[model samples]
Target: MEWTAAPARLATASADFEADFAACLHWSAETDAAIEQRVADILADVQARGDAAVLEYTERFDGLPADSVAALELSQAELKAAFDALPPAQRDALQAAAHRVRKYHEAQKKASGESWSYRDEDGTLLGQKVTPLDRVGIYVPGGKAAYPSSVLMNAIPAHVAGVQDIVMVVPTPRGEKNPLVLAAAYVAGVSRAFTLGGAQAVAALAYGTATVPKVDKITGPGNAYVASAKKRVFGTVGIDMIAGPSEILVLADGTTPPDWVAMDLFSQAEHDELAQSILLCPDAAYIDAVQREIDRLLPTMPRAEIIAKSLSGRGALILTRDMEEACAISNRIAPEHLEVSSRDPHRWEPLLRHAGAIFLGAYTSESLGDYCAGPNHVLPTSGTARFSSPLGVYDFQKRSSLIEVSEQGAQTLGAIASVLAHGEGLQAHARAAEMRLKG
Candidate 1:
């Protein structure tokens, strides 16, 4: 089974790589307005009718019986029981992953008391106070897939940021909770766990329900409907970001094993059909080998059809003349997961600027970052790494500026403020400051 390989050839380079890169934006805004409208109606109903509407919608959409919303709440004892039910190895793994995630997020926590004061000649002082949100809601996707990792990633950060209460919402398909998810919630120190999910869950978190209390901010990932609902409820309740389809871009040299790269590419593709998996290699032979390896491995994989469709439609084997070219292309894609399977990953790390989360070297697979590798897996997708960030403790906290001024300082500062206000045609503002200055 010899694979046909192509030799490296330098193609004509284009100056408008940015425009070429900009073309990818066309893939994102395919948001279904009709779906959004339906989700909006459901959210409105849940907000207005409270627990009854939530139960009705959960049943209608999730094909489950409408149980009491109170039943959604998992007790500490129940969580502990779930933990105890797990096999010894599975329990140990969860504990180890939780510890690693907690340590990483603990380091990311901001010092709340941090303050800087600058006094004017008149004894005016100005500073800022960092504070954590009073309460936060974390949405964990449930049903067929149990993401204990999502639980760890979202809750640990909020905990580290000193969020007083962390409420988690997970969809219980057919009105049943995944024991693993519940156990992980307990281990991650979540204050409460609810079996609600989807757009209604987001609404419940945004606008309080009779059973589920409203939170200051909501952080976690969900389906398209949930993402749209979050976008709609932004000001009403703070949200992390509107996540898009998952993506991964691998920059591999000829030195790396093609099978390893192929498996890594499939890792992201199996997430969904919309998920993008690409490979950028300088050596054309390596590119061809990886493509062949993908074909070889696809038939053996559990999600072969999904990966094949994803690879054929969204994935690519981009050929580059050198590692520098590969890096430049990667910066353009700004993939959610970027793997540098090159001989010298550190040497190229500085040159590689845009990626949601980077996996360096052949040994570090994207799966590590997804599961136990100490970084938040709930990262920005659909090239959002260009401007956004992966979920962290900072996302769950807020900062407020502090100012203290003496009478003399107010006189001095108010004069300047009054002038600026007057220039802006704000007479009332000017008069208010003028009165302070005159006093």
Candidate 2:
């Protein structure tokens, strides 16, 4: 592996650092457009043919049999069997993770409000009302790689938000649902679980099929095709952010261990080749040790080939002037996972303004937030944390502004409304206010 030591200050250094930073932000407009076209084609087919189109696409893409729509739905007996099939230890761990996730999301539920009156030369009542979505669809990736954690993260929040119905869809490999995924769906309080996935599943959720009910929103991570489908069906049904490859930025000082840093970097790299694992440190010797540790640890990992390719291709060990510069680089990257492994993480916490999730101290690992930690692992990726947010209970709820004007209040505010409406050439709007004022 090649190790390039970044100078203390890029202002005084060569042009290499600027070049590498620009390469990191290489957004491909062409690639986005191509993916969008494919998604649009899939959506149009599904809309025209309904379940028949969904079945054909599932077989072609997911390597699963195009079974009957009725067979796709999981029965109560199957859910019970999933819970019974697990060993006591695994079951306990899943339950514990579910508890923490539920506790965190439950606290995020928006509460209903009553109308409040304010004096407007007279009196007027105004407030906001919070209501939960009627139904929601959560996509959980299945097959060889089962993400039971995703089931907990997506479903628990909708449940906490008091959504009336929750439908979960997962790709069953060769038409078989993983027992662990089934158990997670049950534990997370999902009203329905379907063995369907890919772009077809997204389409079914967006435009209701005979078997699957249309949902108010869909939330979860999937492959590129699934993401594109969600983007295409956005106006038809709400969607979570378009997540990209996972990323982890570790801001460490000389106090941290090289092995811990190397392993954490590998954790994200194994997710995908495009996944970025970057380390920014003030100490040059620490960077050297981490690079060496990565070499030693790569062979021991199960996904060593993947880790090696990702680290060598997308990973970097950037040496900064000080902790301030290190934090500045982290903000620029806006990584999905940010780890502050310095001596005093609390002091550096104030400097970190743009990360999906922040891990403090050497003890906190990004893996914890992915599974057991209370925070949602479904975070904004690809530098989107600058504007978007992590998934939460608020994603499943809608709010409406409530307004109630008394007769005297309408009379007092009518003149201003009339003036604005007249200025804008909205004669009907002025007349409505005038009628209320006169009444």
Tell me the spans in candidate 2 whose CA falls farther than 4 Å from its real position: 1-14, 25-36, 110-121
Model 1, position 382, has a per-residue lDDT of 74
What is the lDDT for 354 in model 2?
A: 97
- Tell me the deviation in Å of residue 365 in model 1: 0.9
Q: Give per-residue CA lDDT, model 1, range 179-210, as digits (tens).
A: 78988998999998888889889989999998
Error of 2 at 74 (Å): 0.9
RMSD of every candidate to native, in Å, equals 3.4, 3.1
Residue 71 of model 2, lDDT score = 71
Could you tell me which 10 consecutive residues in candidate 2 have the lowest summed lDDT? 3-12
Model 2, span 245-303: residue lDDT tens: 88999999879889999889988998977788888888888888988788777777877
Error of 2 at 55 (Å): 1.8
- Residue range with the least summed lDDT across 10 consecutive positions in model 1: 3-12
